[model samples]
Target: MSSSSQEPQLPVIAVVGPTGSGKSDLGVNLALALNGEVINADALQFYRGMDIGTAKITVEERKGVPHHLLDTMDVTQEASVADFQKDCRAAILDIHSRGKRAILVGGSGLYVRAALDVLEFPGTDPKLRKQLEEECESKGLAPLRARLEELDPVSAARLGDARRVIRALEVHGLTGRPFSSFMPQREYFQPALQIGLEVDREQLRERLALRVHGMVDAGLREEVRGLDAIGLRRGKTASRALGYAQFLRVLDGGMSADAAVEETIVATRQFARRQLTWFRGDPRITWIDWQDPELVPKAVQAVNAASPASA
Candidate 1:
């Protein structure tokens, strides 16, 4: 007796958590169990040749489950949330058309939100951005940041760093709207079930530190050196990636590998804290202990019991 319009909207299965929490593995498992494909939501994974630092899954580890959106960009190209939203939705639609589920995976907060929530991106003006950057350089960030404070206090408070502040100013200049006004609503753009991996704080800390050391031992410095030769320094997004930045200093002879290792570990831990805070603020996500031995079976159960999505 129900109309077609009342049918459940297609669902997106998202696995999200702090870094080093096994999101990628869970994603692969969920995809295989559900006859699905994973669509990476991690921003850093988009760049090609960023394997070592990103801890990207090897081909063999993927178990032949097709992953979309990884290695889609050169190191030099900027990662854009807007572009990701468009591309992720397209991937979801394409997968659904084939009667396959789409598993969204990553810990990138805003990027994950962009792919799931109702968010509007303000248009950008390159000239205005350049003007703002020039002003920041010539006049210093204080005046421009102060200007943004007056025009968009919300965004001014939330945004940090020169690049972000300037981008906020540029957004206001172009749209005549505060950048914060475009914040994502919690409403889902389609049916979705978010799975969060919960881990012990101390345990995760140890894991992250060991993980960094493993990357270093796996030739992270060599990776950085090769990437630097290829102009990684000119890559805004890739250049600033977690471990890559610390190692860049090592390559510059300004730091020792040991020093960079410690610094990268600290920075990565901080980044993980920030990620945890961001994802924890959303009540829509269902959390599971990362150590659960029955994780895959429970995830499959969640998907099956979820009231959204057809086949």
Candidate 2:
């Protein structure tokens, strides 16, 4: 018997891939086919009044498919993986109760990982995080990375960079334990199928370039101008978002509009590369080359083959 047979099963289809890889389209198609409701796993897509830049699916795009979590949070409020886990669990239960499947979709690797595993993390201390942020501002992230290298070599080695290293150090300083140790040691939740879209690097780059151009034409500059008026400066998570970040450079006289768009496309391509690297480490994810139209039917088969929930 399947190990999952003992638990109250909730049928979930998780569609994960790098940015601009058609993840949303696949999710929408799956939802339509499976009678499922889409629950967003993209962190950036949650903010209300921040639609076009995030490339959020419109009502027409959704084709009347119900989507949860998108447009659910304030731009200023930070949402964590724990909160995502909680929301996703509740959404899945609700979907099951309605006799429908839950389709979780996005390009955010952390969000996808949290949903796929029973993850636990030390409770955060706002003061400690603030202190760490202050330290980062004053001493620079390099010092924090160096400190983590001394204190938790394993984590430092795993992180291998300033941004992640600083975050791990902050968590360690706050929680009085290696930040890595707090992560769930075992798989608590496993999806029946974890589908990943694989696209050729050149193809992905082309898609990204086109998408960036489309965003510019779709008033992305105006959107960033509005965000600037609201004082959403660089370093704020919202401002650091891919499209907004590049546009900010344009508005600040740092780069020409054309240069900014090209830079954004380049950065987005790099980000997608990192996403592919992250998802590649997960053994459960089944990759379907993006050009393969056979992917959807195969995923559908996987879903249908999943064990039914025990009453």
The regions of model 1 sitting more than 4 angstroms off are 1-7, 309-311
lDDT of 2 at 174: 78
Clashing pairs in 1: none
Scored by lDDT, the top model is 1
lDDT of 1 by residue, 1-311 (tens): 35545666657999999999999999999999999999999999998999999999889999999999999998888999999999999999889778799999999999999999999898789998989888898989999989999999999999889999998889888999999989888999988999999989899999999999999999999999988888899999999999999999988899999999999999999999999999999999989999999999998898888856453
Which portions of model 2 show Cα errors greater than 4 Å?
A: 1-8, 130-151, 159-170, 184-191, 309-311
For residues 115-232, what per-residue lDDT tens digits would candidate 2 score against the true structure? 7677776666677777888888898878888888788888887886566776787788777789778665436485557788988988888888999999899999998888677665
Error of 1 at 110 (Å): 0.7
Count of steric clashes across candidates, in order:
0, 0
TM-score of 1: 0.93
Q: What is the C-alpha lDDT of each candidate?
A: 0.93, 0.81
